[model samples]
Target: MSISTDHTQLQRQLYLLGYSHALPSDGVVLVSTLLKDLQASLDRVKELEASTVRLEREERTTRLGHDKAKGELHALRTENNSLRAEVLGHSREADRLRRESRADQYRLSKVADDLRMANLQLKAESAELSRSLGDCQRRCEARLSELDPRGKIPRMTVNRPFDVSRLQTHKTQVQPAIVDLVDLSSRRISALEHEIEHLEDKLSTSGVELKAAQMEVKERDLELMRMNSEYERMNPAQDVGDSQVPRLTDQVDYLHERAEALEKEAKDQREQFAKEKEDLHRRWVAAENDRVAAGDASWWRQAV
Candidate 1:
């Protein structure tokens, strides 16, 4: 039974026995001490519970932040890979362009060599044609003088022989064609060079960007490692604290159980004491009744 109920029952019993207003000071002190101990235990349990809850909250928040940072790190890694692939592709394109430009330059060089040989051949052919024209011109003039005798036919002023105008015309036409070919080749070479320069610029810029991206990724990786290290540093202490909580709780529970057992033992002892007191009181009353009976018997005998 509860202390208050037990006290009330004890008081009623005492009132029935003509001791209505007295209480045992030792019993009151013992009950008060038990109550104080129980209150202290309850307070300790509340504090432990609050501490456990706060630790759990902090652990959950830390885990969430760590997970979020990991997710962002994953995204950065994916982007870094994509940029790396892009740089690789650009690098390959630049290589291909360089190969094409070299091939074009080789072809242009061969064409220029062929044009030089053709110009030499044209010069040699022109020299042979001029000699043949001079011979033909002398023969024609001798034959015309023999046929005309005196001075009937007029002498030619310019004796270029086999139509110099036609040869000049051929030379003019062929020179312009060769010059146009060279000009076209030069323009093509210039255009290719310009295109190569542009591609090189783009490639260089891509290289720079790729380097910057790599640097950023490296920095992020460093930061991530730092964060991980920091988390590692911090988590062990929290884990140690968390691990200790159960042990502390077990200790608390053991104390509470010990207290409860002690309280039960005290209650049982109190009940046993009350039972013994009642038995003693009954024995004393029985002895007094016997004594009164004996006295009445003697008086009766005397009266008789």
Candidate 2:
């Protein structure tokens, strides 16, 4: 500002001096000195112009940096939006999994009830069959005792059990009625076993799906934690308030707990089913042993 004011003043003084008719005694010397001072002022003006240009260039560089920062901020906002969408998608998936888990639990409960009823029904049937088998064995044993009271080999091997030779063979007759009952009992047992196996397969499949769903929930929870970390890392933008983080954290924690509960329930159901199966199997073995103890297969042992 002082330089501009001095230039203006010099211009006005030079015009006045040129216009005046009365010149000073040392006018030549004064004019020469004034010319040199004007020359120095011109050089200073050139330096100031160069400095202005350099300052303008620095301003442009600063503006460029500002633009880059804005672009990066935009990119961060876009990524944050995408992450939020993913979080919503994961929440929906968790809801779907919860529905499916509940359905599976209901199915398992129903199947367990059906299996219990079936076991009870079959247990009664098994008991009846055991009684019948035991009665048949006892009658056969009585006849055998009448023929060979001391369990010794008879003179006529034709009537003996386990005499496979053509000359000494006895045709062991299984009554058609008894055979039919045995076949029916075998078919019933097989059917029950097949049904139980199928139910178990279904349970296993449900469990696998449930586990996979839980893993997905866990992954989403981890992703949510990572997102929270990202938010902390990016701390500049306050567009998204602090409320979302805690709300989302609560959702993830709830999902985690729910998944664990489902898995535990499934495990418990499986254990109960296994125990029921074991009890049914024990009962069946006991019935078979009773039949055998009543002499169902004793004739062959006596022959041996």
TM per candidate: 0.48, 0.38
The residue ranges of model 1 lying beyond 4 angstroms of the native Cα positions read 1-38, 138-304
Pairs that collide, model 1: none
Regions of candidate 2 where Cα sits further than 4 Å from its true position: 1-23, 26-37, 129-304
Question: How far off is residue 194 in model 1, in Å?
Answer: 6.7
lDDT of 1 by residue, 82-125 (tens): 55455445444544554455555555555565555555655645
Instruction: Kindly list the per-residue Cα lDDT of model 2 for residues 1-304, writing each as its tens digit.
Output: 8655555555557676684444344464565577789889999999999999999998898767656654554454445444544544444454445544544555555455545545564455445554454555677777888887888433332233221122122234334453245356556556655655665665566566556655665665565556555554444467346626554665576567657656865776677678767866876887678667657556774686
Global local distance difference test of model 2: 0.57
Clashes of 2: 0
Worst 10 residues of 2 by lDDT: 161-170
Note the Cα lDDT for every prediction shown.
Answer: 0.61, 0.57
How much is 181 displaced in model 2, in angstroms? Answer: 18
The lDDT of model 1 is 0.61
The top-ranked prediction according to TM-score is: 1
